[model samples]
Target: MSWTDERIEQLRSMWEKGLTASQIADELGGVSRNAVIGKAHRLGLKSRPSPVKATDAKLAKPAKSPAAPKPAAAPPRAAVPAAPRPAAPPPKPEPRPAVAAPPTPDGAAPVPKPDAPRIVSIGPGGFIRQGPGDQQAPIPPAPPRRLVPAKPSPEIADKTSLLDLNDRICRWPMGHPGEPDFHFCGEAVNPGFPYCVEHCGRAYQAQLPRGTRRPPPPPPFGGPRVR
Candidate 1:
């Protein structure tokens, strides 16, 4: 693009001011970025003097000389009295009665219960491996053992609460869910003594008794044929 006279004048000043071609190109804009340098060379603009047109665009750069000392600044213009530093604004009045904050809360917000847990598949068979914090918790001291409730005995208090069946103590709270596969369908709870509503009902009939398994019946009491 052809350079405008004004642009050429600015270019001269920029060059005299020791600006690099890149700087001049930025100011001029639009022309091939290299146009500034080409035009200056074609027009015989001498940055220093002995320099011939640069052979390689890459090496066309000339080393910068120390900047010319700036002219002494003109004496500071007579001060016109800066509007009298606007009267130091009056200090903000102190609060009359500062609000007393409610006594700091006894403790900060309660710690949130951890999220249920995200199931992650890791093993080759896609077996789930829990993320960390697995053992951190000390198996919440299994809640106070609730007694397994017996069948809905007539004596049961609320038919709902197992303690009603028989004050029989349970290692675990009664009525709780039991192993999925073994839970019984017969009675919602075992009938005899106190039985775990969860475990007793479904226990193998022979093992129905609450405590340890009973000794085998004395070998089916042999026939007393000794008349």
Candidate 2:
């Protein structure tokens, strides 16, 4: 709305009286708070404190009164002595019969008690073996261990030459073909295998049933020990 002289004067007076822009807008009909503010700014009326800040200051809680000093603590009460407990009676000793020793001939000595049976450790895990007598019988020398001879490998001369190779014969190569000594295993092949019984044994190994396979032998003593 256009600001007439009358409305402008009213706005200046209201603004100077500490009225908010909204209040001035309501007082001057046909004008918005922004319009009133713009007119007041143009008129160069003295700027007033912000109504929001003034309301906040007025609404703010007053400083709390200093807390009252706490009262002094009461003195501790005296403890009363408890009545003494009666002492328990002492236990009576039990009666036991005296044992008498057997009589012996005047010059004879007393016989000694038999020795306790002794245990002999034979192996690991505290294995104990009782012998017929007080002492353990000597462990018989371990039966002499004999090494079983390994099956001799097929001789190179026994291997079949390329010219002699046949479908029924083992096709397992014995040696490098580039060498003059190269030959094929000439043994009879298993029905479905490409190699003979021995060659097949070396070629395709069957997995042993679980828990049936033997553990690898321990390394010999005096060698590097595995931690």
Q: Pick the candidate with the highest lDDT.
A: 2
Error of 1 at 151 (Å): 99
Query: Each candidate: what lDDT?
Result: 0.61, 0.78
Question: 1-227 in candidate 1: lDDT tens per residue?
Answer: 67889989998999889787877888888766478878888778985532234445448678799999999888877768666566678798876554444444786555444445566658778776766755466555656877884555354333334222334433334333552222222333345534456655455355366577676665445845577
- Give the clashing residue pairs of candidate 2, or none: none
Compute the lDDT for candidate 1.
Answer: 0.61
Runs in model 1 deviating more than 4 A are 48-227
TM-scores for all candidates: the values are 0.21, 0.30
Q: Which ten residues in a row have the lowest lDDT in candidate 1?
A: 179-188
